[model samples]
Target: MKDYPQSVRRKDRQETDTSFLHEILDNAVSCSIAIEKEGYPLIHVAFYHFDAANNDIIFHFSKHGHAGDEITDGKKASISIYKYGRLYTAAKAVDFGCEYQSVIIYGTIRIIEGEQERMQAMSDFFDRYFAHIPDSSYEAFTAAQSKPIHVAKLRIEQWFGKEHALPAIATDAFFPAFPSVMQPREA
Candidate 1:
């Protein structure tokens, strides 16, 4: 519920806007979830389900991982999604640079208990990753996998973002206003 300005101040070269943030969430199928255990940082890669409607994130893992165990305990986890925006440049006579957008979400994890919540979260994941599935197959496949997976929801506390631009001033919807920075010249 907390806005970007109230959460944490981030410094980056990319303009964090609404559209850019949405794109990063769209392009990414999985997210790297970072948590801490016994004072050490534990980061695990996870397939994520995002709800743009309420800006919520969902993830599921077997009862195995330490992250699942250490999720609550008054500590929050961080999840990030990014893309490799590599390209070649002709005028510069070199590869200019890769452009990318990323979103960092801070939230508390709550283990999903009811079948309804779990199935709904799974549905979100299915829509994002398997949008191409045929109607019958999709329903059947979901029915099969639904009972097997244990879904959990991440209640977002706050969020922030960063990204790269080609012209350095490209505007987007999900990202915030990116301040232009001048790289320091070597003496």
Candidate 2:
């Protein structure tokens, strides 16, 4: 798919599964993680890297509040991945359709330890988020900064995904846009 055309030009209720997640991860960089500490709601906006084999999305953050300490075991962590890529025309805000791909995964996160695993986790994040990090920078990442901080990883348990686009009418019209669902397929 060159763009979200399949989702926009037509609507047929595109199905999704683990395969779809890999695509979303490639296009996404940041995810919102909502956690609660001491009965208070906490939301962390952090960068993450997705792993296909283990179906896990990993994160490393500086020692903040009790890192992953308060949540119940197997609790759901809501993580949303979103995108809006030139789906709207500049002149018209109501061109009501947006080219968007999003996935909300409710997963269980585990606090990771072990020096070797920690090092690998951080390295994996660098390769995914900053593929352009030079060799020297990578060395620095592994050598010095890998320690002192903490890493928490979320294992993807279930995900809900949707792909969206504007209908042809809205695509041609200049303004006064409204979102329209695709008509059902004929029997």
TM-score (all chains, Cα) for each model: 0.68, 0.70
Q: Write the per-residue lDDT of candidate 2 for residues 64-183, one digit (tens) a residue.
A: 455435433455577878775434453456555556678777778776778888788887887776778577653455546566677778898767677766555454424334453585
- Global lDDT of each candidate: 0.67, 0.67
Off by over 4 Å in 2: 1-14, 37-40, 65-75, 87-95, 137-139, 142-144, 171-187
Where is model 2 poorest over a 10-residue stretch in terms of lDDT? 1-10
lDDT of 1 at 115: 76
Q: What is every candidate's alpha-carbon RMSD to the true fold?
A: 10.2, 11.6
Question: What is the lDDT for 57 in model 2?
Answer: 81
* Strongest candidate by TM-score: 2
Runs with alpha carbons beyond 4 Å of true place in candidate 1: 1-12, 87-97, 135-148, 166-187
